[model samples]
Target: MKINLAALQIASVLALGGCTVLPPQPAPAPRGGTATPAPKPQLPAPPPRPAPPQPQAPRADAANWRDLPQTPGSWTYSAESSGSAVRFGQPGAGPLLAIRCDRTRPAIIVQRAGFGTGTVPATITTSSTLRRLTATPTASAAQNAAVAFEITFAVRDPLLDAIAFSRGRFMLEMGGAQTLVLPVWSEVGRVIEDCR
Candidate 1:
């Protein structure tokens, strides 16, 4: 029938505490006003990678030349009216190098593709010895219509000896560039002997 005053006071205090209001939020800026942009995060740059190594051409040295591996079935021999010729290439194929011998004339001829018209001075090195030679591009003809160049030199005993009997490399330099390295084998020596 009767309420406690202290309990009523406590209930009133609890109800007022529950109705407490939060602080008011700030108003949005006007449409014409410029807003400050947040700062962007920074990142470090990636490290650079190293370049790959390039392939190198073989060096012109006696050890490298003399130690050339023999290409099986590359040397060939043929008969001619002047004398016998030794053809260096695969069997039943066009010759790369032809050593022609005759009582009247003796010479070594080298043939390669992609030669333009003109004469190119060249060097033939056997071991440490070197011989200067001339290379002439083959003429365009109906019978031999190939774009190629050839180097022909008269056979020299010293050059042959160094190529056939020495422990050195043999290289052909043309157009100021070393283009070919010749391999010497026992058969090469035999062919040279027969020509002699």
Candidate 2:
């Protein structure tokens, strides 16, 4: 009744010699044994912090249209930065450039106009600055005095921020990680050419 093979190879070599895969031995510095201070280089826990670079779309300035301006004012301005929404208007005579991109983020605007029999009104033009700032997207022809405009700004889901501040444009928060483009019209964006 004691053939030993039934002992399952001596109980599997005494349970594999008391189970030892060896990798957890840090408890022998007591009983007045003093020297146990060399285990603090565990920085592999910092690779989980790579999600802060999702803040793109702010590195652009290749527009110098001779630095923009030569009178086109009677202005109105409003500001909101990051979450985007702004309003501005300029009209002192012959033509005008009024903007209100009410924020679902679809924007670009430039102005300084009158084309056919021009005199002194035409220095810049860019469009789609909406907030109902429309004149029939050009009621007759794409007349201009000077121009440079772009579009793709949208408001219905503009990456979504509560329907883009409810189409009234709000959310340009400033401070920390730093982001602000409320140029409200930077000194009239050189006199109305690029509405950055």
Candidate 3:
């Protein structure tokens, strides 16, 4: 019998083809038990912080005059030829109240145009002091045109200077029940000092 080379090659190829490739498999479970689960990742915690401080409310009757809001009738100051004039209301145009002071004289002028004319009782109060006075209206051509009547009262130099420099609510009570509060700021002290 003669052996064929082609028959031998075909037999080798068929023998190799009989072996098949397979995918990888997981490890088999342990005897009588399931596989363990993988662990989850965790982040580190942040450090704790302290709380901020809270602001306290101001007490009643406290010297909080600087914190008060400026109204239309608040006191304002201006330089004059003789001295300084601390006024309330529109300057130059017509002021409701004006305190004109010089080295020689001190006068408190209250406009009687909007306020009723004649003798009116008025009180000025500060943080610690109270001054009661009477305002008498006088007629002048200048006063009549602008304020109708001008109420004039003489004020002492020392008292006027003290009031201008004080840091408190300088309240003026007039017209029976009407009250006007003027918050005296630090700038007012500078103005009064410069005038002197």
Candidate 4:
């Protein structure tokens, strides 16, 4: 008997379409046939890891540090050093600085921070305290220096060079406060910061 070529080709094309070409496989003879199990895949080993570079601690900027937030009725102050602390509070980071100068306190206490960073740099700060132009025959200005009060702050950090301040002997100049700034410097110390 001759097989039909058309039938054979149609069966082959249908098989190529992913349909099973044969019927369900029957069980092997119970008495004698041996079956080989499929092999397991062997994964490639991961490449060896390169040695990690040495870890270094991040350098902190002292003058750039910030401390506590401002409280109402109290002046805010911050230093450039991490080691620096104010009687009022700690130093912190900010462009606009706020310093509370106790009218009763004689000297600026925060200078201690500048000293620790090395010899604190000298600075020229101006005050807006109104000063009379001295009683002059031809002068219209006041006799006393009537200008807004501004004081200089020596600094170890260039970032804290400019000062923000409030003046009071328990009484404060609510709106108009003086500002201070430091001269250009070579180096500013690292500011201490709180992690928590």
Q: Which ten residues in a row have the lowest lDDT in candidate 1?
A: 65-74
Q: What digit string (tens of lDDT, one per residue) describes model 1 on residues 73-125?
A: 35566666776666666677766666556546566555554344567777677
Q: Write the per-residue lDDT of candidate 3 for residues 1-196, one digit (tens) a residue.
A: 1367878888999999887677777778789899776567877888877788777543223466335454455567777787666666654665555655554545544443434445667656566566776655454334334334444545544545556655555666554333556666654554445445
Q: Between 2 and 3, whose lDDT is larger?
A: 3
Residue 87 in candidate 1, Cα distance off native in Å:
1.8
Better of 1 and 4 by lDDT: 1
Candidate achieving the largest TM-score: 1
* List of clashing residue pairs for candidate 1: none
Steric clash count of candidate 2: 11
Q: Mind giving the per-residue lDDT tens digits that candidate 4 earns over 4-52?
A: 8888988899888886577877567557666665578989999999999
Q: Candidate 2: misplaced stretches above 4 Å?
A: 1-69, 72-74, 78-95, 111-137, 141-196
TM-score of every candidate = 0.51, 0.21, 0.45, 0.19
TM-score of 4: 0.19
* Model 3 segments more than 4 A misplaced: 1-70, 73-75, 90-94, 103-114, 140-158, 165-167, 190-196
Query: For model 4, what is the alpha-carbon lDDT of residue 110?
Result: 30
Question: Candidate 4: what lDDT?
Answer: 0.29
Instruction: Give candidate 4's total backbone clashes.
Output: 38
Error of 4 at 98 (Å): 13
- Please tell me which predicted candidate would have the highest lDDT against the true structure: 1
Q: What CA RMSD would you report for each candidate?
A: 13.7, 17.6, 19.7, 20.3
lDDT per residue for candidate 2 within 48-160, as digits (tens), equals 55556675443212243213333333445445452222333344443333333433333433322223321222111222121212211232334444332222233332232
The lDDT-based order of candidates, best leading, equals 1, 3, 2, 4
Model 3 TM: 0.45
